[model samples]
Target: MGHVIVGVDEGPEAPTLIAVAAEMAQRHGAPLSAVTVGRDGAEQDGAPWLPDLLLRIREKHPQLQCAGFTLTGTPADEITEAASGARLLVIGSRGLSGISGIVRGSVSQAILEGTSSPVLVVPSRTTSDKHRASG
Candidate 1:
């Protein structure tokens, strides 16, 4: 089996999604990789966080095999390419909306449409909690 690849950002939900990916990886007995994609000049700037995040995760789940990667390119393309041979891909949904609250974050949508691997899009905790409180 292949590793579980997770696309993450600096958003609040990133750690949550990573935790989910780690659990999935443990369940599958596979490795976990977390990737962050940034623009040209800002590419390397965002690279450091994933390694630190992975460290924290490892501290909690010592037996889990995990790694981190940072890439420069369009988020969707980078994530799709990185997840090509992955068993599963996980991402946090920013749930950006248009004028009428229509979901407008195309990166996640594009990945969902383009990737051959299974994609798990998780909602931000604040968003989920808001929905739960409302309902």
Candidate 2:
């Protein structure tokens, strides 16, 4: 199987998607790639938090190897591209209303629609709460 790819996005309510990916990778002993869909950090409230978030995640879960990168285009497209050869694709769902997000969210739905590998969607509320408590 290919490496597990987890797509990171900024969320407001409960976006602790990375935690889910970390757990999975730790359990499966898989190499992890943490990707963000856009350059603006919509996954983390307009903050360039992917690298920092990736670092924090790595610090928390040292068992799983991780790398982080930012995709300069649409979120869903980047995610799909990243997941093309991955054993598992991870993302957060937020009910976006645009062509890209909608298509990609649906694509995520379709990707996991009838397949075997799991697509984990982290909730924003949990992540936000964690962020608040910690920060």
Candidate 3:
């Protein structure tokens, strides 16, 4: 079975993204690969954190196979390349909209345009959103 590829970063949406991707992987009986991209073509601050993140995921979902790595390049390009032939590619949306989303240039949007693989874009969540979900 093709593996599930998840684009990860040190963002507030990361946990949600990883959880969704891991669940998808488990459902598909596929391995999960978490990929992080460094925009400047160098290891980013989150490079060292990827493995630990994967470890936590593995701990939570013991039967799920998980691995993580860092890549240096444009986030969209690198993530799309990594996701080639993947069963699914999962990413978290920054929830940028309107002028801000246009100016910032969304990697998820670019990936949608660039890849044929199925993509899942998880929306960002806020503390208030969490409270509402739990309460």
lDDT of each: 0.86, 0.67, 0.87
Estimate, for each residue in 1-135, the C-alpha lDDT of model 1 and write its tens digit: 899999998767878989999989988988999998888676276566677789988998899999988889889999999999899999877666686345444788889999999988888789778889999
Write model 3 residue lDDT over 1-135, tens digit each, in one string: 588999988867777788899999999999999998887755466677677678888998999989887888889999999999999999887767799999999888999999989999887787447668989
Candidate 2: regions farther than 4 A off: 13-15, 39-47, 95-117, 126-135
* Model 2: per-residue Cα lDDT over 38-125, one tens digit each: 5444453333666677777778987778887767665666677778767787776554446876664564455455445567765456
Ranking 2 against 3 by lDDT, winner: 3
Candidate 3 displacement at residue 16 in angstroms: 1.3
Comparison by TM-score, 2 against 3, better one = 3
Candidate 2's clash total is 13
lDDT, candidate 1, residue 126? 91
Clash count per candidate: 0, 13, 0
Identify the leading candidate in terms of lDDT: 3
Task: Give candidate 3 misplaced runs (Cα > 4 Å).
Answer: 43-46, 127-135
lDDT for residue 124 in candidate 1, whole number 0-100: 79
Which residue pairs collide, candidate 3?
Answer: none
Give each model a TM-score.
0.88, 0.65, 0.87
